[model samples]
Target: MSFVLGVISALTAPFLVVVGFIVWDNHWNGTAFALNMYNCTMTAIGFLIVSIVVRQFVLEPSTEEEIFTSQKIGGLMVSSTIGILIGDWVWLEGLRLLGSRKIIVVDSLKPFLAVFLGEVFLDERLERGAIIGLILTVLGVALVGLEKEDHNIETETTIECESVGAAGTEVFNEHTVLIEKDNNEQSSTVVVDSYAQQRKNRGKQSTKEFIYGLVMAILNVVLHTFGVLLTKKYGVGMTTFEINLIRFGFAGICMALLSFSLWSISNISSTTTSTTTTMTTMMTTMTMKPAWYLLPDASYSTWRRISFGVVFVSFLQPALTNYAMFQISLALLLTLESIGPLYSLPLSYILQGNRPTFRACIGAILAVIGIIVLSFKGITES
Candidate 1:
């Protein structure tokens, strides 16, 4: 999903450039403001829907004391996500300094940063494979940027998954249990081989979670890319709030449809009160929360965060990221943008805290290398 978003962002870069040109030619600066505002509104709505679903369905009350603890944790989660918004704003600001291509390259390094952050903050350790993978990534990125020609470039999007294992760390919900004891007490003293297998499975699960992150990332990328084209053709006299409002609106509508489907199915099953119906109802309903409800609480401390979230989505991302195309070349922006994954990798691991097996380690390394190679267009040029 991340790779695909990268490609889509790249592919759509030209369209935005043209749009910016057209806007400029016609003196349509106001259009830009419209875009920015629209973008923010839509994104907020989408986020809200997703949040609602998570809170309503995905969560189970963890403990008696958790009601308050959960709110505290929720507060912290919102605070932390503000960091993401700040990171995103910085990313947009940096994009203005760089172009899409370079931004992508830099963003591609996100995994590396994520690893480093994971090590420092999350207690994630890098295996030999990860180190080697990082080297490959750097080499590959250099090669792609310095190279004169593209490699076996394929069209269309593809996604790959890598697991960071136990070394990775992330903030946790107190409600979520780390592990459950097995019924077989005789094997309480686990063997090394079983532990390894468990680690491998855990790593695989992390990969799945990353997929969700990638989905969100890609959607963000595509919307920003499209917004940039619009700005370049028109001009920045307009606010990004409009664009964000529109795009987010579309996203919100799509998510709303999803929510409706879930609700419809839930109501259908709610009519049945058998044990199986009850179980299914619980699972599905819990999972189908309106995404909006996922947002941080409306507490006074969170007001700034909520506002920033709104502005970043509605205005900054659409206008600034697109405006960046004019200042920095698209290639530079892309390079920088590639670093986003690096930012996420280790944190994801820490969040889940699963260890990587030797094989999984090797796979992760190779995958990172592949990602760099894909972003950089291979190492021959470098």
Candidate 2:
């Protein structure tokens, strides 16, 4: 049951991220916010929600590693800030500026880039096959990125979307197609116009913001690469959970503090602490993070959705993943998990009811194959 739950968790994780981002954006749509402020606040809220849940429910202080020493905290803080906060900040910026599919083109470079960075910084050895795998993976993603752009079909029904920015430009090009079917004496026109508005809104961006977004994405790759190396160096043999909790726990508090000063929500009204806050042994840890000050006007329904969503994203998924590992080898679990990016295809189909291009699908398959090769190679060597 737990392993099934973990598989379900893995399958839903990507969908959850895309959906959750949309949900949060709707809640905070009114603000012309700084990118860092918005990113850090959301990061804090998500991390704090996870830390609080895990500490309260899953993790026992006595059973877990108490590896939160001063040096560890400091190093993890760097990872937290650089990897989590800053990486996500630039990522969102790129997402906003370039759109998901386009930014995904940049992100697809991560596997090879990480391998290269690891070799340089961590002195990790790489095989020739691994190098080939990395290159092939990038090439596959590049193929995927070259989605069909020309869809100038004229129909009786016209769909229009008020282009907000560059972000929506990246939607559904992978799945856009003209469908024609014939009955005995009539033809049916099936138009998937869900993102019709987005399709209409493509010609709405300056060249400068486009270039800037790409630069930010590349820089994000670098920051993330270094952050992982730093985490390994400074985290001192801590498990993934320990590393994440300490990093998130500490960074969440700091971001909460920053959020307190960034907005006037704290002084506008102070609701009493959450009823569940006192139920944890990590009371001292909880005090530093502001779980609700950022969303003063959130309705109960919104709060419930947001809280549960964060908990699922941060804790339940990882928790189930860890639980699944007990029943499988670590390498096997990782190799199984590495196919996550391929989920984007079926996910796009399920969520949007649109099929990706044949070329893009083949590219995705190749990329996943490359990842499998790399994964098995690492296991074979180690």
Candidate 3:
């Protein structure tokens, strides 16, 4: 049941992130920095609460080596925080730009990237199956890109204008044209307005944003690969709960200090607009009730759901995933993680009644085959 829960948690983790960001984006128009900070802070608080409760009831003491005084553990915490912070920020930014589906597909490159990173940094030997898996993973990513391109083509809007007295019709595809009809100026005006509307619709497809998202997605893979390697090397003698508490607690403090500093600067800048008393009140409200002040207004139920989702995703998911990480090699672990989309496909189908596209199905199958081959190699070598 624990293993089953871990697998379920792993499969649904991305969806939870996607849903949280979508809700926040829709309601609060939240920045990635704000969301990341809130998530870290909440996770830290949750871990602290759980730790206090467990300490009161359970008396499992840590060894001297497990104490937090060691320089090695300190370095691990610093490096891990950097990796998690940057990785999560860029990942949310990617989701903002590319949406959940595209970002998730792009994330499939993680295992392939991790394989190379492990070989270089961890002195892990790449087996023949890993090499083959890398090829298939790349191929699968390419197919996903193709699907995106097809989606773009399908979304492209074309306007066909048949002028009243003109000999031929003029067609415009995502571009403006000054069409002057011989007899009907009103008709020409209508065509121009229609073309303007089409342009407005097409403006939503931003090539620059898509490219930025793609780069961020790739950077996330690189950072996460390094993080996993660091954890496998230096995460010895620490409980998962201890790791989460320390890492998130440190990050939460840093983020709080940064937020306060920014708020102070902003208050100083706007001092002329408001009296000192009003400024102090504003600052107090922001500090004492940050979430209520910063986040968008929603119903109590909505806020409750959002809070629950964040706790599950930010705290529980990592705890379960870290357990699985300890049980497998970094390379094999990442290879298995690549099958997340395959799990998501069926889950999405069952829950949302959304069918997978043919290309997505093909990509999922390829990724699964690669994972199976890689896992088989790992077992045989062991």
- What is the TM-score of each predicted model, taking all chains together? 0.32, 0.61, 0.66
- Residue 68 local lDDT, model 1: 26
Better model by TM-score, 1 or 2? Answer: 2
The CA root-mean-square deviation of candidate 3, after full C-alpha superposition on the true structure, stands at 11.9
Candidate 1 per-residue C-alpha lDDT over 218-319 given as tens digits, one digit per residue, 9 for 90 to 100:
433443333333333333222233323333444444434545676577667667678887887678756553232122123554344434433433333334
Q: By lDDT, highest first, what's the ranking?
A: 3, 2, 1
Q: In candidate 2, which residue pairs get closer than 3 Å at backbone N, Cα or C atoms, i.e. clash?
A: 161-197
Mark the regions of model 3 whose C-alpha exceeds 4 Å error after superposition: 1-29, 51-64, 91-109, 130-218, 274-293, 379-382
**Collision count for each candidate, in order:** 126, 1, 0
- For residues 1-382, what per-residue lDDT tens digits would candidate 2 score against the true structure? 5445444444354344434333333332212222223333454455456656776798666555656678887887997778766776676576566654576577665655656665566555556676665566566656654442211122312111111232222121110111111112221122324234443554366788778888988887677656656766676545445655665566566656766685555434333445465344246534443343343344778666655544544444444444433432222333333343455456546754546678868878787776556554542232
Which is the better candidate, 1 or 3, if ranked by TM-score?
A: 3
List model 3 lDDT by residue over 1-382, tens digit each.
4434444444444444433332332232233355456667788788787767766677577545545557756766765565666766676556445544465566666666766776676666667776686567545644643443333324332121211112112211001011222222344345445444443444586888678878887777777777777766666665566667776677667777777787777667667575877767777866442441133344777566656656655677566556555554556566554443344455545644555579977876776666556544543132
User: Where in model 2 is the C-alpha error above 4 Å?
Assistant: 1-66, 145-211, 265-293, 316-341, 380-382
lDDT of 2 at 130: 61
**Clashing pairs in model 3?**
none
